[model samples]
Target: MILEHRTYTFKPGTVDKWMKKYEAEGLPIQKRHLNRFVGLYVSEIGVLHTTVLMWAYDSLADREARRQAMYADPDWQSFIAEIWALDAILQQDVMIMNPAPYSPPV
Candidate 1:
């Protein structure tokens, strides 16, 4: 299995604002398109004002297809526009991970 790890660092005090918007709007649209949703988290110590999102996919192709569909959705497009307008994010990091041979299924 493949895991997609997305980390978004929001501007100092804007994390709560961003999270509120995401939960109210983006979450539903994203959930409709991506099925292997894993979890969402916020940093407690090391990196303040950062959110981490995890998603599992069968393969890179599956991830691409699912994300492409989400991007194509009008609701998602509108949400992206709103997020950009909010200008709350400072940086974003994405990583594609492969499970270790001995690791349990996620």
Candidate 2:
């Protein structure tokens, strides 16, 4: 199993606005194509105006296929357009992780 961790850094003071747009337009599309939804988070201390998403997959190929499908979906494309209109995102970081031996299984 593998996990995909994504951290999105948004322009300062626009987190709430962007998050609202994502929740309304993006979450449903993600739910349809993404494999496992772990959690969504916002930074409060160290990195302000940042959002994080975590997802689990059977393998890297599975992750790639799912994401590709999502990107091709019309709904997802529109959501991307909406986000681009907001122009709030500054940077995005993605990390592919494997569970440590000592880590408990979900």
Candidate 3:
């Protein structure tokens, strides 16, 4: 399986706002189009104001297809537009990882 890890860093004190908005609006659309939802988290120690989102997919192609569908969906577009309007995000990073043989199933 492949896991997509997304990390977003926002300005100070904006994480909660972003999370709330995502939970209320974005999560529903993502839940419908995306693969397995691994977890959502906020950094508490180093690099404060960071949020991490992880999703599991059967393969890279599956991930790409699902993401493309999500991007095409109007609800997702609206959610992202709201997020961008907030202007709180500072940086974002994404990684697709292969789990070790010994790792537990995602």
Which candidate has the highest TM-score of all?
3
Task: Tell me the TM-score of each prediction against the true structure.
Answer: 0.95, 0.94, 0.98
Q: What digit string (tens of lDDT, one per residue) describes model 2 on residues 1-106? A: 8988999999888899988887898988998998989889998899888889999998999989999999999999988998898889899999999999887654
Model-by-model lDDT, in order? 0.92, 0.90, 0.96
The parts of candidate 2 lying over 4 Å away from their true place are: none
Candidate 1 wrong stretches, greater than 4 Å: none
**Pairwise lDDT winner, candidates 2 and 3:** 3
Clashes of each: 0, 0, 0
Q: TM-score ranking from best to worst?
A: 3, 1, 2
- Candidate 2: give the clashing pairs: none
What TM-score does prediction 2 earn?
0.94
Deviation (Å) of 39 in candidate 2: 0.5
Which stretches of candidate 3 lie above 4 Å from their native place? Answer: none
Q: With candidate 1 superimposed using the best TM-score fit, by how many Å does residue 74's alpha carbon deviate from the native? A: 0.1
User: What is the C-alpha lDDT profile of model 3 across 28-92, one tens digit per residue?
Assistant: 99999999999999998998999999999999999999999999999999999999999999999
Model 3 score (lDDT): 0.96
- Tell me the alpha-carbon RMSD of every candidate: 0.9, 1.0, 0.6
